[model samples]
Target: MKNRLMITAITLLTAMLLLAGCGGQESSNVASDESGNKTEKDSGKPKVAVVLKGLDQEYFKLAEKGAKQAFKDLGVDGTFLAATTQTETEKLINILEDLINEDPDALVVMPSTEAAIPVLERYREKDIPVILIDTDLKWDGKTTYIGTDNYTAGQEAGKFLAEKLSKGDEIAILEGVLGTDVNEQRVKGVEDVMKEKGIKITASQAADFDRVKAVTVMENILTANPNIKGIFTANDEMAIGALKAVKARNLNIPIIGIDGTSDVLESISKGEVTASVAQEPYDMAYKGVENALKVLKGETVEKSIDSSIEVITKENAGEKLEEVKSILDK
Candidate 1:
């Protein structure tokens, strides 16, 4: 009878232990579900890092704004970093490397130089998709480029200048930094059209995309050559600087520049500048983010996205001006 009683006690103990084990397992599963970190998507949204060439320039600031808007709309985590200046190639590359180390889901970059090609290639090897915005590098690793058709935009500016100038009129070119693809392509486009039209370019100089430097260069060009009748500045800031220089000379020189920045558009409306090739930077930003999300979803995006450009002159300045305002309004 004692053996029977002991057997019953042991069986009850075994059953209790098994039930406790099952309860513990159920609690563990509930805790795991509550903690919520099993999958990548379950943890949080993907991350993207946006790197710009510089933050000081108005152009770069606008690009950054676009990027921020894109991130917000896409509902992704994005961080923006900038090199202090366009000439800071090493710093820019370092920034890129640091961001890459974070293992961001994607990167959108505005490269300062072609040397960044290999660095970007590394990102591709790691299976991280990259998008180029505003400026481009010579790498196939990038999934898409979202910005102006810079070459065509330059050609349009050239054509506008050509139409405004008569035969053999002396025109001066204020180029951005040398060797960068954006500046090179823009300068080439202008020179190409100028070559086709048989126009004379009396002076050309690199202003390093600096407004003050552009002003100094324009002043020198004006002082050295009294015959300059027109100016082609690679960017709106430079064009405005040239306008200041021209106005200081008490002379009228037709100026055509790129970027329909609010100030540039205002200059166009005020007849201070002849025209500016307007780049839809905001739309570029919005689309870049939209496309990034699409890319994440395994949707195909175009290898290149030309945000489109337009000539904003006094004739259509009001409409162009309003278009930019509407973008801001949004």
Candidate 2:
């Protein structure tokens, strides 16, 4: 009888132990679910990634500042990436691929080339929204485009030049990198306006948007057309280069450039560069992040966002320079 009682006790003890173990596991699972809920709530804030063309340029640096400000204001996590050189398409593609792997809530990109379009398509397949800034691509998958109206800005530059020079005055154009939408649209606007004004385009050449290349191309153009009255460069970098070439030759001619970079504004102050079509890169970046957040929240956004542009000349260079400096300092 004692042996039978001992065996029954052992069985009861075993059943109790098994029941306790099962109860402990259920409690642990409940705790795990609670922890997961906390994590989900904490991670509710959207994360955005911004990829620029190149960070070496002052214009992009300002845009970066603006994007940082947007992060601060909107309380979202933001990452910025860029290529070392504007022409480094392969490098840009690699950077973007890495960004895609990160699986951010949204992407803001300044495409270095149209080749970036296919790489960005990967994001679309994953349902990630993309906002394009500064430069544009020929892709239909972009969420929205935020930057200056290049064609209209170029028209403003052309009109400014045409008013200063006579109808028959010969001028030269220092074009940016060939085949890019920014270059093509700006050049087209200039050509249309110059044609309407009866301005003779004595020489036109691509400088690849490099200062050194601009110097060489300007020299060649001057050698062919010595009597060129004025020059219009696609961007401030090329404008600075063209100015260097003209200064070396001891020639005084009106030179207009786009993008009112600090260096270009200082040149304008010194009466070296005639004028520039000032683009609000900072505004573009800030708004781009804002739009990205909106899209992530399933809110409606505009298909196109123009940050606006202005004409900066010696008369307003000091004021504009101060404004730009303030933004960069922030």
Clashes of each: 0, 0
Candidate 2 wrongly placed segments (more than 4 Å): 1-44
* Clash pairs detected, candidate 1: none
Expressed as tens digits, the lDDT of each residue in 78-193 for candidate 1 is 66688998878898999888777778788888888888887888899999898888887777778999898788988999999999888778899999989998999998899999
- Residues 49-160, model 2: lDDT tens digits: 8888887778888888888788778977667778987888889999999878768889999887798888899999999999999887778999999998899988999999
lDDT on C-alpha atoms for all candidate structures: 0.83, 0.87
Error of 2 at 202 (Å): 1.8
> CA lDDT of 30 in candidate 2?
21
Q: After superposition, how far is residue 27 of candidate 2 from its true place, in Å?
A: 34
Off by over 4 Å in 1: 1-43, 322-330
Q: How large is the C-alpha RMSD of every model relative to the true structure?
A: 10.7, 10.0
Candidate 1 lowest-lDDT run of ten: 28-37
Worst 10 residues of 2 by lDDT: 29-38
Candidate number of the best TM-score: 2
